[model samples]
Target: MSEKKFQTVQLTLEQSVESRTKLIQGAINRAAHTAGVVSLAGKGVYVIDGLLMKSGVTLDVQAGVTLMGSGNEDKYHHRPGPFELLRNQTPICALIFGNQCDNCVISGKGTISGNYRCFIKANQEQAAHIESHHYPRPEMIYLQDSRNVTVEGLTIIDSPFWTIHLAGCQQVKLANLTINNEVRMPNTDGIDLDRCQYVVVQGCKISTGDDGICLKCTEETKRFGDCTDIEVTDCQIHSQSAAFKVGSSSFGNFLSVKVVRLLIVNSNRGLAFQLRDGGLARNFQFSDVKISTRDFSEEWWGNAEPIYITFVARDHETVIKPDDGIENVQFSNINANSPTGALIYSDVAGRIKNIRFVQTQLWITTEVGKMRHYDLRPSEKRQSLIMPVSGLVGRVKQNQQAGLSVMYRSNEDQPD
Candidate 1:
């Protein structure tokens, strides 16, 4: 059956953050039983707090409007228990929580600003000491367990944490998004697809401090663990961390993920897989990528490797199972300029298997002050290992068949 659309509810509110919060939440409550459109119109910044989405609702942030997220701690709702990234007393939440809402949309040509300036602790970014607000930072958009969601054409800015997080969502599409966070800010990931299935992200221009496009199977979303059948294409991304990555958390299985036509520039790492929590990542294809990486401040993870795929235990004593690995991964038609080459490593034999690189060209940029360490951070005491820079460097366990199909070009003529 077709959706029974309700009349448009145009929100008119005062400048106070509390008023906007009340009005927005009231509109959602009023539309709970039926499908509706909550339109934020006009050409001014509306101080918005936590707004929970409802099913079949569309949040129409109009062309000239802006939703400015309030930084006050008490204005928004938060989780009862502390998250792993937060202090024990700090609360975790999002500015817009689309929890279990199906057929919802957040589409606009306007902007959504997280107003991270109010949350900045100290403006410092260098050598693993980026000053951050460890206290009560919230994500920008947390769409949890929702299906048939579409977020497009919005200019999302200065997110204190992850900008667009689709946690356990199905059949979603994100397109034409312009996301820009402070490049030196910590943990401001552009878009994170956590335990989601059947998602497509295309035509996004994202520049952020952390990973531009990341896939995660975190412990929080363990119940919905099959993060598979996703595609990201035609995106221009830049980040202090990996432009495209899967991890820092891989507790759940991932399969059939494809990323193509990526323009990655000035990122710390071009592509990566940080399988820390020991899950299988397989049947992935990365193609038609133009990547340029440079060494950034040690404050972030990554060390300029154009292709970094590592399957190592997070801790020394943490034992990895025999099947915990990345397998059947292919990289095709990739051209990269970076200070370091690709690093594919696995702690056990056959753990990293069936890798293919076809028409992969590399131009190793000059390494003046860049670190020569393969950093596997969020691990045990020894987080990094000093290594010689080389083209397509890998370290599988001794006597393991690499199962390689290689076409790599070093000293390739780089494009202007």
Candidate 2:
């Protein structure tokens, strides 16, 4: 694996859309000061108001290059002077800006158009004169605190937010991405791995409004600690939310993860392991999954569950911090057809441990109706134990024996 010798620089197309953003930022600062290979060939529309690549540069976007996004939110929120307080709360502003770079690369098969409805009408007219979190729409690739990053074969479309944001990265590699946003686009997340480490998202074809692939540790990323050894393989996810998620900004700690062979279609929720605020979603492994969830609009957070594990206490009057919950999980060979049937909650000071589901095949259908129980919540402090299956199968209604009907509730509220 040794074929590295680039010094190619070929960019020149200024037919004046304001001089094509200063001739593509001076041909990417003359191919990032000669570490070269900044080729953006033919069929031009190249108008970038932002681009800051540097370390061992290689922004080779060829195959009839499009790279357009000069949807002027004050020229992509201008503020890179004194590093602007080290990217002060990155509200929008990013059309390919990799910082703290190592062996960087943004490969091709061109098209990076994040002209998302003119930046969502310029963030709704700058949110009626500022302060709706200072609305400034712009992100079509913002890799931060980088290490050996590589974004392969791109076809990234209309993203007004989180299209590919890898923060505090380390040895990352995102392959075959074809993110197509605007399914009612709001927070357009297709790939967002924050506080990253040893990452790899393979053969991706994400469809999103939000959270098609997300793993975060926020409070604006707590100094890049634990979002350890990740791996997502052969994905084809669709989401309004949760086609694959980790938290609701879980502070940090999601070690040794693995999601294999996924195909989640028409999603509202499928495999969301959320431990709000303080996070420790331990040793997860979800294999060969195929989920098809429905039901949307409670303003979208997901109820058409194919699996939604939660360990709450984001605020039962605050103070539930250190490593909240969700442990040693495993779900093997699942094939779910949802009408809302899988949820496991834990919030009496968190404890949802050693959960396992093997050779599973669930089909809970009322043809999109009947959702009885199984949306576990703080229904009087939770604790779980639903393990007894030799290849569990369920498809309720009519002579019912596809199995799985257990209900136990006893804290003296008797019904064991």
Candidate 3:
């Protein structure tokens, strides 16, 4: 795989990074530096090491570069410059600004702060001695296998791991980005677009601990199809989890997701499309969402339920056989104000068609319970929750011109 050669380099904030470090180490030693810019006016640590850290490398940082991280220079946080407080150090562990670089573009208006501990704490056993704490590794601004990339207007702050991680890329575009952590920080995932493809996340503003804006493609990396045509528009996803999510890692196949004009508020679980264990989601949509009610106590695993869609089969590494559930989903014109009345939950045995609540209006301050749809009854044996069949339960048996407005209710109350 060798036939890609194009480079550009530019570094501002008044040059002279110690007399241009051997002319920036000879235009990154023959790869010929296609594009590089780091406007220094700073507290230092612009130590981009190795064959200038291979893979094409096209970095652009103009408007005031303050790339310093290693934390703790007394307090008030943020410190550790001089290439991470050196003393015969070479800890430049794969800091390749842009890897597999195609049409790379890491825009100006800079800031890539790090110092370890956005959050990570492991070493369990809460029965006796064993215990540990550190948290905050959400400092991963990695854009892997890059393609037509564009990480615009950056202001990435105190990421101890996930500010922006676009793994296995293709035609990526994360616009007007601004990711931050410190809401009880632990594995702070602000913007994680893993196993990427034609992505477009616009006008971002994320608050994190987990799941601010996540669209993952996983099934243990066999690379199963469909992370298709994504579009997350006009964003502001403040999260604790599910400001927006699809698949807990759907053996791949998290298809055609579209979230338009969102302004998610105080999220614990606002607008979610989660596939319980397996994945085969299709043409998903969530439009015009706005939710608030940070905490009115009740969050037993949190159920503010603005609109939750779940499909559980479990096992991406083997054990999922109910035909790895979830298929063709739709949620339009969303509006929320829930106090919890089971807004939505699809347990999954298949066929979750056109799930709409058009021109939606929900302000159920408590008690609107039961809207479960689990399906699976063809002598395939047990798995039914009923109450969903606007159409396509046995291929259009009812909706019969909306007669009796369509009826079928039975979870075990029977009597019909």
Best by lDDT: 1
TM-score of model 3 vs. true structure? 0.32
Report the lDDT tens digits of candidate 2 across residue range 196-259: 9999999989997778998987655567787889999998999887889887666677888999
Show the lowest summed lDDT stretch of 10 residues, model 2.
Answer: 390-399
Best by TM-score: 1
Q: How well does each candidate superpose onto the true structure, as a TM-score?
A: 0.90, 0.34, 0.32
Candidates in order: C-alpha RMSD to true structure:
3.6, 18.7, 18.8
**Whose lDDT is higher: candidate 1's or candidate 2's?**
1
**On a 0 to 1 TM-score scale, where does candidate 2 land against the true structure?**
0.34
Better of 1 and 2 by TM-score: 1
lDDT of 3 by residue, 1-416 (tens): 34434443454445544434334446544442434433323434453221132344444454556554433322121212222112322211212234566666556676665544412345332322111143222234665566787878877765555567666688888888787765455455777676577899999888765678877665433342457788999988777656777656555666677888888776666766565445566667777766642332221124445555555443333245554544455555655554432223444433344454455555444323444332221112233444432312222111122111212333243221
lDDT of each: 0.80, 0.70, 0.52
Candidate 1 residues 1-416, lDDT tens each? 44554444444555467776777787776666666767776787777878888888877787878888887656665655534322344557888887788999888798999988778766444434346557447889888889999999999999888899888999999999999998877888999999999999999999999999999987656777678999999999999998999887887888999999999999999989988878899999999999888888777888888989888777665546667789888888888887777888766567887777777777776443344788888777558877766676776534222432223334355456
